[model samples]
Every structure is written in C-alpha cells, then in structure tokens.
Target: MSPPYDLVCFDLDGTLVQGTVFIWQTLHDFFGTDGDRRRKAKDDFHAGRISYRQWFEHDLELLGEAGATRDLMLAAIAGVRPTPGGHQTLAVLREAGLGLAIISGSIDLVLHRHYGQVSFEEVLINHLSFDHRGALVGGTPTDFDVDRKGAGLLEIARRQQVDPKRVAFVGDNYNDVSAARAAGLAIAFNPRSEELVETADVVVEGDDLRGILPHLLDE
Candidate 1:
C-alpha cells in the first residue's frame, strides 16, 4: 500500500523520547529549577499572564543560573533513552516511503545529538545560544511556540512541497493538539492527558512506538 500521508511530523519530547521535556528535565537533573518560582512561571504561562516566549525565556534564564553549560546539558542528556521501538518505528516509516519531520519546541542541538542516528528530512525546533566558552547564553528565536506548532508543521509541508492535506502529525500533549489538528491527520501517541486524546484523529497507546505503525496505513 502507498504511504498514508505525504509527510509525517513527530514531536521530540514525550512523544519520541518517552521522558520529560529535554531542557527542563535536564535542568532538574543538572541545574535544579525547583520551588515556587518554577511553579509560578508555569502557572502564569498556562493562565496566559505570560506568553510561551516569556515562559521559555524565564526557564532558560533559570537554567543558566543553575550552571547549565553546553557540556552540562550534553552530559545530562546522554542518559536519555528513546521510547521503546522508536528507532525501529522510524525505520519502518522510512521503508514505507513516508517523508518524516521533527517539529518540536525542545532544544535543537540536544535533539540533533540525541536522535543523530535517526533521519529526519525536516526539523523545526528551537536552538540554544552558547557563549564562546560554551556556557549557556540563551535560546534563539523559534517557530515552535506553544499552540503555534501547527503553523510550524504547515511550514514544513510548504517547504517539502507537500499539500497540507497529505500530512500527518503525531504528538502527546495539549500543546501538540492545535498542530495535530491542523495537519491532515493527528495521532496521539501514548497520550498522557485527556486533552490530547480528544484532539487527535487516532490514539496509539503502548510502551512500544511500533503500535503507531498499524494506524498509519490504510487497511
């Protein structure tokens, strides 16, 4: 059978890595971001008192304060593991001749290194800034803002010369909902929240990433 979609986009964090967000989780492990300040920033962002840009900026600042240097981030990320069958799933998708893309709000260098073995034709993610000495400076502007991920996905399709209706986007969070819905097809992979379940066209639940493969092809 032909591939179900012209292009398929995957979210990098929980969807692929099967762990917490790379930057924050790394911060918690290497450069602690605990306490009231972190909570307030999160709450404010969810409440719209602060924008996603501000939330990320605040988080990066806190991380830098906690001594998050490039080397430290690389060390913290070294231990991260991909979701079960993540590599195999990508292989299968490629074998089936689907264009694959990564659309994420996570740090670019981190994801690039983590998933370096895998191949993605299009990658839309945020970049981290580092000083000459390799200390964390900040983050570069990114198109993967919360709720705007759909726009990024569409942009990928545009660049790939694929129709929007021929795209599939998979994610595991409420932040991924809008993007998934905007795509031609939406798959919620091991959804951790109710909002994600309701937002997706298909839901695949399992410790293994291969579970999504069956849903990607027409019967």
Candidate 2:
C-alpha cells in the first residue's frame, strides 16, 4: 500500500550535505585521549540514557577542551557545501510541490547558520547555548532522544499539516532506517551504508536529489 505524503523529511549530514565525517573526526581531535568518550556520549543520546541537550553539552565540552572556539566550529561546518547538485535539487523539489524538512543530528551551530540556503520547511537539530560574551553554555528543549529519529518525522508531519501517508523520507545512513520505515517512501540516495541501501524502497544513484522527485510528486 502506498502511504500518502504531501510532505518529505530529509537527513542532513550524509543526505544533502557531503563530507559529514569531518565533524566527527574534528570532535575526535577535541576528545584527545578519551576518544571513546565521544562514541559513548553518542550512544547515550541515542539510547535515551541522556537528554539531547546534556549529551551535546558533555560532548562539546570535550570538543571545546582543545580550545576549539565556536567560531572555528562554525567555520568547519560552513566549509561544508551541500553535495553536488544538492542545493539545486532541493530547489527543484520544493518547486515540485513536496513539503521539505531537515531533520539532522548535527548541532544547531551548523543548521542555525546555514539552513536558509536550503529553505527547509522545518529544522530539528541539537544545539549549544551561549552567553553575551559568546561563551558556550547549554540548549533549550533540554532533553532530546537521538535514537528516536522517527518521532521527529511524526512531529514534522503534524506541524506541516501533512498527512502521514503523504510523506517520503530520504537519507544515507543506518540511523535513517527508522525514519524510512516510518515514511511513505524510504529513499536512499548515493548511499554509502550497505544496510541502508538494502532496506530502501528507492535507491537513487548519483549526486542529484532531483531523481527522487518523480516518486514524491507529479508534474
């Protein structure tokens, strides 16, 4: 049965943006001797053992410990342009009448700054707060569950006034599998993860996100 979805949710890092692992590697640089700490914090966030805000603070403190300023963090992410044709594809998809959203595990530092380029209908991401002097502090919506990527989609659908059956989801990693399972169509585009490719209902090969347009809309 085809689910109805006038809406579509997208994953950020590996889906629209390219070279996502660089941020992870950068965090590792900040982690120093306790590199495993990064992974552990991520696991805790995903498993609901800790809130998203707490997990981000704990991990970013480790990242900032190396004196990595928030400016530098922003630059690292800003340097990341979307994958080939990503911007245009998003433009085309939006023009095609599909509601677009950005759901990512990336921090607000990145999305808050650059999300305008993509014009996502809604953006749900982690964040780190700061003071007037620009010192790192904490985030609101204090507790977020990273493992429950699917819940965000449901929320997005409701917020957009789009029917659950009308939504289509796209991603490039294992974390996205749950969102895919929950969406009307689960699409893996130029996917690097083998498991993700296997479970996807549509495998879009190559750089263009426009490829998935046919499935989500009629023109």
Candidate 3:
C-alpha cells in the first residue's frame, strides 16, 4: 500500500532523543555557565515580559560570554544518545516512502553531530553563530522557539506542497501540542503530560520507538 502520509515530522529533544532542555544543559555542562541568567530570562519570557527572540538572544549572549566553542559542544554531545527506537523508526518510514523531517528548538549543529547518521530530508532547527575561529558568537531562533510549532508544520506543508491533512507529527512534550493539532495525525510518543495524551489522536508510551509504527501504518 502507498504511504498513508506524505510527510512525518518530529521534534528533536525528548522526542527523537532521550532528554529535554538539552540546549541549556549543553551550555552549562560544557562552558561552565551556571545558566541562572537563562533561567531568569526564560521565566520572563514565559511570564510575557520578553519576546522569544529576546529570551533567545539573551541566552546566546550569555553563552558567548562563557566562551562556548565548537570543540566544547562536541565534547558535551559525546555522552548523548538517540531514542532507543529512533533510528529504526526512521528506516521504517523511509522504506515505506514517507518523507521525514525534523523541526526543533535545539541547536542544529548539535543535532547534526549526534544524529548525522539518520536520514531526514528536511531539517528546520535553530542555528548558532560561530566566529571564524569556531567560537560561539550568537544564535538564530526559529518558530520552534516561540511555541510556534504549528506554524513550523504549516511551513513544512507549504514547502512540500502537501496538504496539512496529509502530515503526521510525533512529539513528546506539551510544547508539541500545537504542532500535533496542526497535523492530520498526532502521535504522542512517550508522552510527557496528561494534556499531551489528551491532545494526541494516538498515544504510544515506552522506550521503544518502533511501538508507534503499528498505529501509524495500520491507518
């Protein structure tokens, strides 16, 4: 049978991987930045005191000050790992002829370093600026950063020339709720909250990513 969906998009941190708030942790772990400033900025952003761009810029500046370097980030990512079934699921999707992509708030460089082996046709992620010497200089936040995941999904649909109704999104956290709503099918993988489960059309809980395939393929 033909693929049920033309595109399947996934969130990076905590969805395709094993953790959340990865960017913050990477900055702290590698650069020795306490991240207290970022915590305050995040609170302010959440409280509507700052725009997402502002919150992101403030943290980028902090990271730059802490001397975040490419070498340091690479060192930090060395200990990270993918979701248990992440690679397997990607292969299954590709074999079935479904286009795959990743839309995430996490840094792109980090994702590439860790998941470079995975085959994804499109990747929409935040970019970090680096100096000629490869030291961190700044960052660029995408729609994923401002709780605009739905918008990201729509943009993907537009680019792929596929109806939004022909897309499925799999995600884990409350942050993914809007994106799920935007897609034709919403699969909550290893759901993080009651709200996420309630919002999803299908919920798959467990460490194995392959568990999600039955619901998806059976469609």
1-219 in candidate 2: lDDT tens per residue? Answer: 332457788887767777664345554553352667878887887687987667667766776665555665665565565667776767766766667887777666665564565667877766667667665565544121234667888788888887766788888887677677667788998787787788789999876667777776654
> Is 1 or 3 the stronger prediction by TM-score?
3
Give me the runs in candidate 1 sitting further than 4 Å from their true place.
none
lDDT of 2 at 72: 59
Candidate 1: RMSD to truth? 2.0
lDDT of each: 0.82, 0.69, 0.81
Q: What would the TM-score be for candidate 3 when compared with the true structure? A: 0.91
lDDT score for residue 163 of model 3? 96
Record all residue pairs in model 1 with backbone atoms less than 3 Å apart, i.e. clashing.
none
Each prediction's TM-score versus the true structure: 0.90, 0.82, 0.91
Task: Give the per-residue lDDT of model 3 (tens digit) for 41-123.
Answer: 87899899998788778877777787778887767666666889888898888888888988787788767876888768778
State the displacement of the C-alpha of residue 74, model 2, in Å, after optimal TM-score superposition: 2.2
Clash number for candidate 2 = 8
lDDT, residue 174, candidate 3: 77
Ranking by lDDT: 1, 3, 2
